[model samples]
Target: MCIPPEAQWKRATIPDRRSVPFFGQGRGLTDSQSLDSIPPPPSPKLRRAQKVAEQKAQRIQDFKQRCGPGFSSSSAWQARPWQHRIAIEQGIRKQDALPEEMEVVEDPTIEEPVGINPVQVEVGEFEEPTVDVEEIVAENPCQNYHCKHGKVCELDENNTPMCVCQDPSSCPASTAVFEKVCGTDNKTYDTSCHFFATKCTLEGTKKGHKLHLDYIGPCKFIPECLDTELSEFPLRMRDWLKNVLVTLYERDEDNNLLTEKQKLRVKKIHENEKRLEAGDHTVELLTRDFEKNYNMYIFPVHWQFGQLDQHPVDGYLSHTELAPLRAPLIPMEHCTTRFFETCDLDNDKYIALEEWGNCFGIKEKDIDKDLVI
Candidate 1:
């Protein structure tokens, strides 16, 4: 049968389904209808890239799962309506279609709760923080230290604090020569401060340790002590000490220098007219007066020792500790050195209370430590 002209023309113009451009237009069509059929097998490089992409996606999913609801990779996509529409179009349908316009309108019917309960998190009790011992030691390492008067604290290589004699130059300057003192070495210092500072600088040396402040004034010719004078020295010194205390008691109306306990003790001696006043008495008069007022002499010697033994209070006199009493006496009294040297009966460097009392001619029974006021 011959086909009609209109039907023939229509059939000729219609393209074959296989020949028409489809999703995989460049690739030849086959009977298969799956995504694998649409595209050919990728190159080795592309396959490797695809594998890497799949692994990255899997890692992201695992990270989200581990983090729970606290983490989300698609938060930005979810926040944007345009992104959400694009994602939906790409994932659900690949056709060009206009997205439905969405208007966000607040719903008045959805009311907030009138009174919501606040989240009450149960907290554990707080504990005091513990400090490290090293940290405590490191903090103000120089604190709680003891150094000599003219010395300072310093840290060593191991970060340990130590005492070192201060530089003499660091000491404050003397305003006048009135403050000057002379050393036994015949050296005159600008001030007592300068003398002590120089002495500190010479610490641990033989000459320095032996050196001492000789007098209040500059150095002068001090006569050598004779044997007779040395024997009489203690008598004069005892008398001097008693007189000094009496003088202090008489003048201590303000209660500034002597304590009330000390004043009470000295008051008895002050009232005693039999007590010899401080004067240049003959040796016979001194000896007679001391024999009569033996009790008066005991307290002064003990008091002097107590004053000198203060730095460590070990009941012994160190050379430096004896400076205040010994220094001034050394220049004025020629027998001072011989007297003190004889006092150390045991030949020990320090002078014990017993030795000191014995040297002053106090009887053994009367040489009481209790008298050290």
Candidate 2:
């Protein structure tokens, strides 16, 4: 994800593809708290402990719902209570939690002294454990440093962490050919690590500047794009894009995958009686629908460009910026490479917003910036 130290910041801004979607970013709270059960006996300490555990569990569940999907609030209280961390970890954000309270459910037979107040016991009886921050760092200084892909963090003589290119041989070997990748130099490498490490070695040279990952698989012959095929490429692509969005809208009952503007745009396509549903349709049908519903495809075309143009939010797209979309699409859509190459009409090594729209058959006058949102 980076070329060198100078380029590390750029790739750091790109979100990791592995993250689950976060919904209601600004919403402060979720209404996930459930009605609590009362303790069998009337000791206030037991009652308060039950109350504390219920509140903690409710907050944990709310966090799950905020992060979204596969996390629900109906589970029983945890077997153990939250442990108090005397010193917060370097990069971890702190969350609200009671310190080292034993689970009331796990130790049901025990009882707190009837006359003692739990609040005073928690505050006055307990003291924060003294920990040396330096000892933690001394154990593993490299753990806190952020290293880009193809690089590893290492401790120097002074024990300061720094990024260095990783050895390709250290990368795990796989027997499958699918693990292989081809670089822009047309040389096939064993894996992504091998490819990127090779690139990292080339650092600040002209060849390094020129070299990039070509595609996901081993290099092979890609047929040249004929005039007719290039023209028809957008027909299937636009229809496919529109149907994808519509499908997301229909299934997005709880996903919140589409934004407000995107939902509004896709609603038109979802409700249109003439709109094409996703399936393997003949080329003639694809072309016919493109002609009939030309307006529907325009926003999808521009929206895709905006999605990929996010590293620096510039009007142009570099090869690195296009990798998220391009790498996955290339194997299925062979024309993908030639289509994009031809899109850069001025041969500036970057595709501007106008060139992208033109490639998808949007008229120059109809390519509105408002549609990109």
Candidate 3:
């Protein structure tokens, strides 16, 4: 039969101990665990716990010194004996050796967390659209000149102050010609023209371009043609073209004192002026020489070199004094080739009239058949 439930539990429990001494108690089973030999339970004071906490703190610091971003520089790991002693005594991390990579434990004095949550944004304030005001156009006050009742005074081309009239006949003081031409003779003209009395009629086409000549003669049209000749036409145009080219290609003396073309032209002019001054020949023969060879072909060449060197338009250099120059342009042996090259007649050594025609836009066939190279 099963023992009663309480009686079985009582068997598992030691019988009431009336006879054993206080230490010799529980189990004759273990001598070491006898009641008198049983050791006291650990004290509530936690001396081991304190030691364990200190070890754990030491381990944490060692871990930081070895693995933190600034690990090598940490005082705990620093090779300096004094630093090591300080680390051991203080048990506090050095601020200078604090790991850059570590998320520092927040300290109110040294490492406070910033409040950086995004601010709540409120939306839906509507702004009124601004309207731009336009400038006002004032009315033209049309004042009446004839009857003193006009609505607005009219403005003239020059925007001068003037009265407007409804009737032309009533205002004699307000004399105005809608279309007018004024005439004044220039006192600077060498001689007065009796034909157009007050003003000399400038001999020009309706389009205002002056006429040119085929040849100079004791022609009545010479004065009207601005004293230009068929012979001088090419000379004048060449000089003008040379001047323009010189003007455009001109550089300051600092950049380039004189260009090759300019040097050639200056030399040629200098040579010609020297020839003219010797006066070994009659003026008539020289005049004839100028006229004969002028328009033929060499006129352009001679004219190219035969003008005064005016000051450069950009004003880099002051006007140079032009004296009667006496330089032999190019040695005689190379002069012929140099002349052709200077003219760019062939853009090569050969001097061909066809090439000259091509360069100057003149007809090749029109070049004088008798002209010599």
Candidate 4:
């Protein structure tokens, strides 16, 4: 069933991984196995988890002993044990300079109870409410089960949450032109949702495997890239990357377009008043500017690689990972495939950071691992 984003995001508890018991040969002990014969947890991962849980329980017990039996810590306190940290964060911590009104949850009073979770706080008193496990489960049966882009979670005949392919018609109509995307099939989709939902229907097919979101906008005719033009593709791309950074710097807005580290790096480029402005300069002009301001292009090359090398993040980008950069450029630059294929150099079907850096004309020495940020 299709659900609105606001409704789908409703907060409710669902079953967690901890509740499920691991069952496998030589993993979990059999019920018939005698207590003495039982092995030290076969799974090192499970043993680590148990050790961590035991340490937490011991710490909580030690804390209760230190604070006295009457002192009952809230659930949040039991979870994090950070009454002073919470108080300091919420600006209610009592210091020698501050008054009693600025008291931390560690020093609670009957007159003014201050702690985490307002639901647990009953006006002037704090009490943990009796929870109805069934009721919470009913409200959020699908909470733990997240579906992919074109699917939604719904209870099946057995009342178990399962992700189903969403109907393309259920997708909301695009309000702007840019929302319409072109797929690798050279057909324009109403929106990304329409494309993904349609693609989901064709799952496990030869067509589906080849299909991908080609670009951000509708399909348009792009002239074939010749051998000579293909050679100059990198020149134009490097220039574009540098100019994109400069444009973003000039329009300095902290809408999370770039991280603080990225901002600091771009700030240096922005300070250089001699940097090229945003425009459709000729390839010859672009090449000349790249030679004149070579340093400005290096980080942008690394930055683009970092942006795409995120799925598994092993310092290597697979074909799927490169899709975001490649798919968009394919419709505009016909040399997109040839250029990337050339970058692989070894034809390993994966592009490393070094390969990506070299493709952009960055010197072998300048392509440092430290610049990947």
> What are the per-residue Cα lDDT tens digits for candidate 3 across 236-270?
33344434434434444453645455455444444
Residue 115, candidate 1: C-alpha displacement in angstroms: 29
Q: Which stretches of candidate 3 lie over 4 Å from their true place?
A: 1-184, 188-282, 285-297, 301-373
Best by TM-score: 2
Model 1 per-residue lDDT tens digits across residues 19-41: 11223222322223322323333
lDDT (C-alpha, whole model) for all candidates = 0.69, 0.69, 0.33, 0.70
Please report how far candidate 1 places residue 156 from its true position, in Å.
6.4
TM-scores for the candidates: 0.57, 0.58, 0.17, 0.55
Evaluate residue 137 in candidate 1 and report its C-alpha lDDT on the 0 to 100 scale: 41
On a 0 to 100 scale, what is the lDDT of residue 43 in model 1? 40
lDDT of 2 by residue, 1-373 (tens): 2122212311332233111111122222122432243333344433543554455555555566565656443332221111111111210222222143455776456556546655324445767888767644336777778886678998888978889988888888857988888787989899988888878878889998888887888888766767787777888888878877788889998757888888988888788899887888888999888889888888888888888887778888988888877776677777888888998999999999899998888899989877777
Q: Give the worst 10-residue stretch by lDDT in candidate 4.
A: 5-14
lDDT computed for candidate 2: 0.69
Q: Candidate 2 vs candidate 4: which has greater lDDT?
A: 4
Q: In angstroms, how far off is 184's CA in candidate 2?
A: 2.3
Candidate 3, TM-score vs. the true structure?
A: 0.17
What are the RMSDs of all candidates, in order? 23.0, 45.9, 25.8, 44.9
Clashing pairs for predicted structure model 4, backbone only: none
